[model samples]
Target chain A: MQSLTALLGLLNLIFFKPYNAIKMNHLNKISILFFLLLNLFFTACEKDNPTPGEDFGTFDLIFDNRVGDQAVSLVNADATEFPYTNNMGQSFNLTLLGYYISKIELAGPNGEYFADEISTGADAAQVKGFYHVLESDPNSQNIRLDRIPAGKYDQVTFTLGIDAETVQEGATGGVLDPAEGAWLWNWDAGYIAFGIEGRSPASPREADQFNPENGVQIHIGGWKDIAGNANMVNNVKRITLDFPSAVNIESRLSPNAHLEMDLLKVLDGHANNVDFSTTYAVHAPAKGKVFADNLAAAFSVDHVHQ
Target chain B: MHFSNLYSFSNSLFGIGLLALLLSSCTREKGIAPVAVAYEFAAPAEFPDPIYTFKNNPITKEGFLLGKRLFFDPILSADHTISCASCHIQSLAFADVPLHGVSVGVNGLSGTRNAPALANLAFKPEFFWDGGVTHLDFAPLNAIESEFEMGSCIEDVIEKLNAHPQYPSLFRQAFTTEKVTTPYLLYALAQFMNRMISDQSPYDQYLAGTAKLSEPEIRGMDLFQQHCASCHDGILFTDYSYRNNGLDSLAIDPGRARISAFAGDHGKFQVPSLRNVGVTAPYMHDARFRTLEAVLDHYSEGVVASPTLDMSLQRGDQLGIQLTDSEKAAIIAFLHTLTDRDFLNDPLFRRE
Candidate 1:
């Protein structure tokens, strides 16, 4: 009975003495719970109001894929009627068309710069700011950038594909995830920054699964610059476009920049007038360098809506 | 009366402890910090810093186990008939059996290149005969999607994994995600492969001063340093450079040229590590030589001429290395010391 008293005393000294010194009572318990609740409330409030007294708004980037003046209408691979014609008078119809956009930056006339948060990791939540714009998926074409400080933005810059640094970060999820329809070259081990697959009469009849008879697949991908290997190419292009007019981003107003990517410009650029017959099957980086060179001129900021 | 008072005091103390536990559990639900069971990954002292980006995917016990299951499971294959383990058996130092010169995949389709032994992969900057794959995470995609291998795309594999009863929960436990993604899948596999460090070989033990080599083995080691050390240098025994090694007269497979797209790289293949070379017979990228004797014989007298052939193999008009029968036997005896039995028989890598 004496030993039990000693044990109780020890327990009281170890666990309860600190609380006792603080005057533990019903009121203290109530106050502690209140403080925890206050912490939870403040954390919740912090997220909504990241920067107090600062005006912020959402900015939308609308990618409008077009074949010259007409909007891109994705045709079936087996479709016989070709809707688009190149400068070389070769008729072609696209079955699939897409490109990865990352490292977005917006510049204002007043020197206000906003660079989108870029991160790559195994977790889907950690992988951010990578937009895979596909012709088939209309929803993917619209990218909404939140928490933009209110400013009159005049220009926007973005990378056409996943950069070499991001590729070296190893496997990434979200839009960069290959399982979710990401164009990845497994053998070469890099993301295809831009890709176009379609049927053209000028293309030779190569009766393979990926390349059906008269099938044209132009995949621009390669993000490694090995030292002393001049033959190796980096096709990732940085595209900068000037907005037609300065658009105000305020809490009440969510401005949108509609950018048009013209397919005809890509095929008929001054650098290399793509002859679809011979240049139909472009799967390597060197093979697609000519097409990737035209990507900068292919994109143009058509309009901005405030 | 005093004892009763003490009991009540002790009861109140217990109540306070319960309250604290409840509050801590609430904080955990808020996701302040995730509790991960860490698995230690330490490189051998002689090895260089690992090339794998471990910061992106830290090694956890759960993640390693998930990866091990994936490695052994045939579900990654199209018809569910072939697994990574089907070609890469653990007993043979993760190399295919001798009969399988080139690994047979789904629907009994044979691969073109010989299945290389997987050991000390974390140290390698590149993978495969052509050295096309730059990252370990991206390596499996080739095997999974290749027509001559697993014959399944990453999309279908993810779909299949999501449909599995246990895989989704296992992945969730490993990666802390609601859905299994490609990165997590690759991370798990990489985690498993990275742990396959072969540092317990007799040669390694000799270097560590725990064991000693025989007279012939010592002589062979000296000869190896004199002849082979220029290419197969350091602890891993590979310089990781692309070389033709006089495999053929003409570039038939277009090996490294397929990746580099250069005529200079034609017929060139990455120098494979000689670790576990004793067990990984059916040698070279094409699996041309079935025995170590034949491999040495090729090095001695059978090196064919090629435009992109390694300069080391040619000494003016001489095409190959000069080695007698005794020297070849001694070299083979030394090569046997590289086999790490502990790594080959580790039950941790076995299917549970």
Candidate 2:
């Protein structure tokens, strides 16, 4: 009985120690916090598609815009050789390089705006600024979209140049932000529906100098209304394409030279009929219409992504 | 006999231990001081939600400070002379001042394009007037790498930052890493530009019921709504779409068409936002019109018909809408209301 009393007393002392109780409480709190931290670490978005870095996948767009060679303008032919015999007796150099294509739309063979939930794509918005194609694209810096939904499409429609609404939105949208050297309508003022600048001294202004001033910047736009006119049907031109069948359009589509703009011929009818009385002048209305219409009609189905 | 003495010592020990633990936790309870996050936008309710969502990069005091440092750092340039602020001045509402219409670059070389104001940029979908850059984070590379601008590559900017002692720590604190990158560099600059929301103008006040529009202003608004609103829609004053407004429908630049490489895309360009048109004179793509009167004349008697001309313009009866002289004055008065004076005087945007 004496031994039993001793054991019971020892047990009471061990169980009732305040230091042990405090230690146990501290340990429990630590474990809970550890678990919470572990959960957070695991749940954090730590996955990288490849390298965890600042860049997402890039959209490398290679405009086979070279296919534009099919279009032959009298002043600027679709091919490389000069296509003009002006009053100066010298053939104007014809470099068939094109301009900015702000937006694009696709239409089915039936003349309907291509729309489908299965295969989707955001409006292919360009990263604003002037871009050029070298003799060869090194990193395959062709046209790369953020990503489009996978599906079969009948046709693709797109805008060859800037649209009217975008013209007034300023540097926020469209292809005319000062950052993007695409719109240089500073010649007479206002926005240039089409801008063509190159080295040609035979024309007005110095050829070879990259001058925001004093250079020949042939901006051929302003399609909404001619300042004082109504229903001008400005630069909004339409081109329809019909696909052979449901074509897989999971990749970027570039219709080479099939989409052509002869930079030289843009002003073929301008110098003679341009009215420079005011601070702002423009190409003859009828001639501007013909150029825009013919250019719009040039874009058709080059091929289908099957 | 010693029980009282033992109790006194043990009680004292427990009391001191408890106080220490409690005090340590209380010291940390202030929670990082919730650093001040003042946007100082002075924005208006009428404007659309800002495009700078602060996604991935949250708006913190450290972030703003880091961005401000980058803005003034010459390290962004090739030779390290020009920062973004060199061309984009504060007094001119972030626009390049002087008569050249172009911004000066490294070696005093001037750029080919006009230096537009970076005001109200958070509302824009694209950056330049041509609408080439869709995302704000990447816009700097263009000017930085432009032969005439800063003339540096994105990789070069990163290299320069590594050499600076203050910048490394600043970047680490703001981005949570010791590493610097293009997106980080751009993200910081974009944050500064995005926060440049200059909407507090007389027009904003009139729209918000705090002020009233004058009769001329009201008349101008009506005329603008009928004639100009089709293209310059919404409070931002632009529909954010590309157009060929019949400026010169030649085959020249083919504005937006070059990006797409399609024929129908020819002769198209982006419309500009008209928020501070009065202060940002030399209007249009080329800074052509010296005054609002010139632009009004272009609309009243300057329109030339082309196939691509917007159909809405055709509805004005005659070839174009012939505005009376009174109507022109009213429109100009309304456009003047868009100027935001407070933005021009903000000290935060100024070089400290």
Candidate 3:
């Protein structure tokens, strides 16, 4: 916004001043030209203005993916190691699992809600609340929540997928930047709200005379819904998880929320247990809503440390 | 002569000479003095707010110039033989010149759709013939990574840019970051393309009550209002909605269906802005029409029937509007009035 003002001010100097000065006295014209040049010099120097830092508390949100009691591992080089099995009796191995978490809200002691500011700028400078959680890297698992007021918070809530405004804003920088990977579904013009990719022998393609080890690529994404159409609901799922107990937070103390994601629940928690033989790959919103629902239901706050 | 008159004469000459110096300064490659002036992106009275996230990436002279350089530079391609300007030339209203049915890429491969014009793009909510890319900032990624186009990924382009002796510093000046991230690159390119506003046409003047259109052009305008206005509506000349437009019974490209993944969206393509329709040809998603005459002919009698065809185009069984030769001629004249010669020759937009 500051730059916009500078731009307008500069424009007024060039266009508005020149138009009026062209008809004015000679001395005035010469003085105005010098003044214009002087303004330009100052504007150039202002380009390097240092971004002021804000004083705020930070909170860490940690995500850990698991199956039953054992931690989920990436597929090995031999490709024969399958450690987890779903309720449908299909053994599978995960190659990738990632999703976006945004619009986080923390309920304070007196029922006051402390919300983290959503960075809308397309630059790394605007990064704050948004984070990408991937199972492959433990370092990437920790999402730093900034600008929280120093206070005691009880319940924590966050959306499983990106909000409508951020989706509509399109590709931004930092975690939301599309250049980081193929998370942004180019065709749909929306982010893959939840992604789970792996290989399963029980996949329908394996039985259909294709590769015996057919891959399971599940990308849940969609953001538009026609008013009358129930089937066309773009699967933009929002999940708000309450901690098993209230978390105590303070300015001096660094608090961490350790959350656990049970893959078993994603496949077998509901009555509609996913069978890899028939349902492995899902791209549409209506088809993805089932998985989105399952995935949203899978996360629980394991513990909170203050 | 009075003393004041002599001073005024000399002062006027000095002003002309100073203006020449300033313009020459703008054309310099580097070491040009930083001027406080910047290009303004004021939306015309008739136009809506720009779709670009200006609050995030503010417009600056250095930023716009960096974007312009990238737009014209072939370094963004794998072989360094093709730049964005290869397909979007300024003289042709930023559409591919010497029109090809589909744009050819690095290795002589061809794209699936015709290269659309890059005029008044800041107003568009979505982009591409299929409306696949939602933001103007994300649009370049499609072309950069396409095997049929630049044949270079963002990673490679970033490496090349960082390695370049000049680009790293230029990136720093445009965006305050030392390392060129994907967002800064996109933001810079967008800054250049978003400023490509083409609104000073004779039609715009007519709206502004500053210019008068000829009788034939007026008649063509009337015909346009009656027939083409529904789809090609608004001052930007597009509603930005995807429609079948009865282009094909069985679409070869699958158009909007590729994005929506629905059979109902098959054969649909985004309605392109006709701001510079006269110069930007051959037209359509496949470059099917070489001239405005051919485009008019398509609407008059060439619309094909399909299940996904826009209902508005269906008038009984026979598709398309009925137009005589005179009507076609007048419409063509009216389209010509939509051209703005000033934009074509704008020195600010030109490469240094």
Candidate with more favorable, higher TM-score: 1 or 2: 1
Candidate 3 lDDT over A1-306, as tens digits, reads 447547756765665565764487877767667666765666556644322222246678899988888898887423876778888788888888888787788876666467878766666667666767888878778877766665666677887776557766655777776666637765456678778878887875542332335767777887664332222446666666776666655445688889888988877767578788888878766577777778767888888887
- iRMSD (Å) of candidate 1? 1.3
Candidate 2 per-residue lDDT, tens place, B194-311, comes to 7677777888888888999998899899998988888889998888777766566473566555443345556666777787777776666655567789888877787666666656
DockQ-based CAPRI category assigned to the predicted complex of candidate 3: incorrect
Ranking by DockQ: 1, 3, 2
Error of 3 at A293 (Å): 3.0
Worst ten in a row by lDDT for model 2 chain B: B1-10
Q: Per-model C-alpha lDDT, please?
A: 0.86, 0.54, 0.76
What's model 1's lDDT at A210? 67
The sequence of per-residue lDDT tens digits that candidate 1 reaches over residues A7-72 is 544654554455653578776667656655654555455544333238788899999999987889
Q: What ranges in model 2 sit over 4 Å off?
A: A1-306, B1-37, B40-44, B305-307, B315-320
Q: List the residue pairs that clash in candidate 1.
A: none
Residue-level error in angstroms, candidate 1, position B298:
1.7
Task: Write one digit per residue (lDDT tens) for candidate 3, span B56-107.
Answer: 7766767888999999999999999999999998888988874576899999
Q: Residue A105: error of model 1 in Å?
A: 1.1
Comparing 1 and 3 on DockQ, the stronger one: 1
